[model samples]
Target: MSAEIWTGVRERVLALAESPGVEKVFGFPYGGTPLEDPLTEEELADLERYCGVRLPDEYRDFLLHVGAGGAGPTYGVFPVRRDADGAWQWHGDGGDMTLPKRLAEPFRQHVNPEELDALLADQPDEEAYEDIDDYDTANDAWEERLFATLWSDDHTVGAICLCHLGCAQRQWLVVSGPERGRMWDDARCDYVDLEPLGVTFAQWYLNWLTEAEKTAGTVSPSETR
Candidate 1:
């Protein structure tokens, strides 16, 4: 689907989530779209067959609830609503769900920019080793280390899935961990470091979505399903 379609779906989903009777909402930055074919049992089976990976139960339930919407190629969905107490609720079909332990922990601690800088600066200057692929090469050792550190300490950060976009030279961070995930380009990165936007995951998602809308323009209602 086009960018316009995803925007409209996102707005609708957010509205539903904030409406009464809704508890909470969640979404992904990328993967599938509202315009794409609704996920079916056969499709799920086919995906597993082709991908050779068994999706986690929580993720499966998430897909069943919110098919796909947002900026990325495939994403989760949710509706935003207010609770009786006047607090906001991120309501979705899937009830309280837990993310994998491996993916949680980073959000508990602040991302240490000093540590990341030190790690990145200490890397040895050398050619790529055959044993380690490009991602594992010393050049990216610091980034991986930072990500691993965040992943191990906080469960919230772990929920945000990481994916490389475009070519090696130009890539972006896609944060799809908790409520209303979105793709974060370089600008969003700035916001994460400066603003008090909740947890790292929430800040990242909101920053990315806000920037994406500015860059891509708003989606019209007619484009939504």
Candidate 2:
């Protein structure tokens, strides 16, 4: 990608992170680890040639901005989980990694701009769902309750729905709340339009790191590093 395009992508991502509805921005490592499995220039060229499709502008910018693994804070980004053993692993600072579609499932669920707008319009109290487990919640109980109280008159705007495709490593995000149904008898649509990228599984793991950062409440990588 051109330097100008890369710069534009970085600026856009940062701007999105600053948006009122956006809670955080996530970067997944593509290729591999920098120090452990760094991507050689020749290898990158070969892979690009093999793929035929140049990576998206924003995604390419992400690679340059974050480098190959270990470039940013471990938190906020999801870490790669080994399918064989379910153990977590981090990509080194430089490596030949690819972003996998499975890893991006979570973020794509709320990709629909309209749905996202609705979610933001009726944003739930962050405190209410603090205890909800990201991996084991049986239902959207906390979210539903909060939506009921917050948007009692209109539920369609506050409904929450699960992503059908799942997130990185089959993780899920709150795309809609329950109030939209009880109040408006309206069927909620929380799905987004973004397509998932097919890259290395390690990219999916980057999400775990992003979650960790959110827990720590630090912005810059240095704060979490």
- By lDDT, the best candidate is 1
Give stretches of model 1 more than 4 Å off.
1-106, 126-158, 162-164, 167-225
- Candidate 2 regions with alpha-carbon error over 4 angstroms: 1-41, 68-212, 221-225
Residues 70-107, model 2: lDDT tens digits: 32322223322233443222232211122322221222
Q: Tens-digit lDDT track for model 1 on 105-153?
A: 3223345768656755666555545554653666676656655644343
C-alpha lDDT of all candidate models, in order: 0.36, 0.32
Task: Name the lDDT value of residue 77 in candidate 1.
Answer: 32
For all candidates, what are the clash counts? 25, 47
